[model samples]
Target chain A: MNGVHDMGGMDGFGRIEPERDEPVFHAPWEGRVMAMMRAMGCVGGWNLDMFRNARESQPPSFYLTASYYKSWEKTLETLLLERGLVMEEEIVASRSFSGSTVAGQPLRAEDVSKALKRQSYERSTSAAALFKVGDGVRTRNIHLPTHTRLPRYARGRRGTIERVHGCHVFPDSSAVGAGDDPQWLYTVVFDGSELWGTDDDPSLKVSVEAFEPYLEAL
Target chain B: MTLRVRALETVLLEKGLIDPAVLDLIVEAYETRIGPRNGAKVVARAWLDPDFKRALLEDATAAVSSLGHVGEIGDHLIAVENLPTLHNMVVCTLCSCYPTDLLGLPPVWYKSAPYRSRVVRNARGVLAEFGVNLPPEMEIRVWDSTAETRFLVLPMRPAGTEGFDVDALASLVTRDSMIGTGLPKLPEVGP
Candidate 1:
């Protein structure tokens, strides 16, 4: 699905220049590591059921596997290893795609791979709780990285707690691959005028599911 | 989960736990398949039936479930019908928790931070961006969907759309129509 960013082509308001250079570079084996980490993170964070169901179906194109990363090196490595097309150690030592060096030593394929995986896991697990379901609350407009169900328009807006949908998946900054941590999920309800002002129709009301961090006690 | 979603995916790829190919599939499935067709049905029905439309304005959930969509938000699903005297739009305000069961996934703009933040503050101006020019006399009701009660917009039945069946009427109810920015038009009025 095209996001707001993807709508750049629709009108003059959203246009952005495409990057001249490619965005990622990693070996095939290294790429598999990243794919696995993401899948695990998503399953653990947002929809574990989706991950399990996808695995059972064994759909060739499921995003839970390593073959789909864009970097050629990662794709090749995952294919060779998962399909047994190549030995494990052969690609580990190769450094053809090295973009930088750390600690005065060229970063090994394994070291970079490990760092990426660690980062993914850390993001899915962190978030502080400030409120709960059934509590009268208001939204805060502060922006941060990690998954947050709160919509932008409702910030600082008052609403009532509808339900504490047990901790489900968080979609804050981390859900999108940013470095931020996870947040709790809650459903909030708002009056028509609270959002649309006095001109709003009296007959209608809006309800939405949001994360805990995006809200505060009213 | 835009930037962080990507960043996390990158980290996972480096970890060798998941396959990047699978991630693409997940993204594709969500983007292409799981979206707002559910709510389009409601918008279509309201555009076609007067009795059902009346029922929706009075009690939206029952009216919608009559067509077979048990909303997933909570037990009490609220359907805000937009009328001539009043116009209603929905926004997550915090994120994009739309009535997927009735509407499917929200459109890209519906989930935007700009749309989410500004619509409630300057709804008239925002609607204008979508080419929705409303008279000042028309009340603009914006429903903030939070909590367990999900929301779907019941757009007004367009003029010149008489005699259309539910399916045909639904075909005219695009996602935007339910968002309160656009209205379903009769076949002759469409470009």
Candidate 2:
């Protein structure tokens, strides 16, 4: 969507401040928000792409000001509202008027460990990889409005395929009611000069795990 | 913001959409059980066992799983070694995608705009701020984890620590080193 959230390479954000002895969650509410998001994940209503899209689609003004967990809270609200699990008025009033039936059982406390295990996004595909290691390719000059894993900085840039990561679910297809359309993923490495158009650092290289859909034969 | 979160929780609870006990369990797991220590243990084992290190660089998911440090986000993990001539770092420019199962939740600075926006472009400059001043001859490889794959930097072991056990070596592995922001702590010199 070319939103402000595609923050790679843009300047003037100031210094990186590493907090000393930082806590996992700054406040109790932050933890609660995390739990809520994960719990909703077990409901099986949305995929990870939808969850990310909800957050990235936030208005720039709100997105820029909201804390990390606050953004999660907002994404939760949007997901619930979109799924008809909760209404705007209910969220505002902190009360549920409609007896909406949740589609699936919430994640049980005992199964939290299992739930935290890695989700397998890898899907079997008969399609062969279009590009191999050391093959030169270019990212399509695309500005997709929907959810996409390809970052804005790498678009329209030439790179070399460093490794092929097998077929995985395509986020662009899954985000907006599309199916789990899997595609071949590759690690494309670009020289710093190629991406930034400057020879400031000859030894610097940037790599992105680009889906086949985002790349073009150069 | 807390109030908003609480409000959403209230609605979810009243609608029977979530189990409160589950929320507590999730928080407790992250707060107590999972964290960077898991990654440190993995890194320490790799240092001690050359075969394991090879396996880790080849297939981190299976290698780390053998040690029982496996979980979500840690799947498809890739271990990039920081060699004398080349270094590796990781970032998620579009969002804060991190190996949370292995390293715990990402630090605030990692998710911040400055680090995400600048690290890929000026990695040497960013690493310098973290007290990781690499030489001009060292190549910096910044991996922007824009897909499901996550990255963990296998920092070079410090010199003169030949007999260090896994516990001793794990102690030297800091969270930042695994993330490529800082190097492992050097062995203390006796007076």
* Candidate achieving the largest TM-score: 2
Per-model TM-score of chain B: 0.74, 0.96
Query: What DockQ do the predictions score, one after another?
Result: 0.09, 0.77
Query: Which tens-of-lDDT digit does each residue in B1-191 have in candidate 1?
Result: 22333443444334443455565544333344434566666667666667877787666656765775533222345677776788887766543556654554355456554566556556676777776788777777666654334566777777777787877777777677776666665576657
Fnat, 2 decimals, each candidate = 0.14, 0.81
What DockQ does predicted model 2 obtain?
A: 0.77
- Across residues A135-166, which tens digit of lDDT does each residue of candidate 2 receive? 99999998888888888889999999999999
Q: What C-alpha RMSD separates each model from the true structure?
A: 13.2, 1.3
Residue A180 Cα positional deviation in candidate 1, in Å, after optimal superposition? 21
Count of backbone collisions in candidate 1: 79
State interface RMSD in Å for all models.
Answer: 12.4, 1.4
Give the residue spans of candidate 2 off by over 4 A.
B69-74
Clashes of each: 79, 3
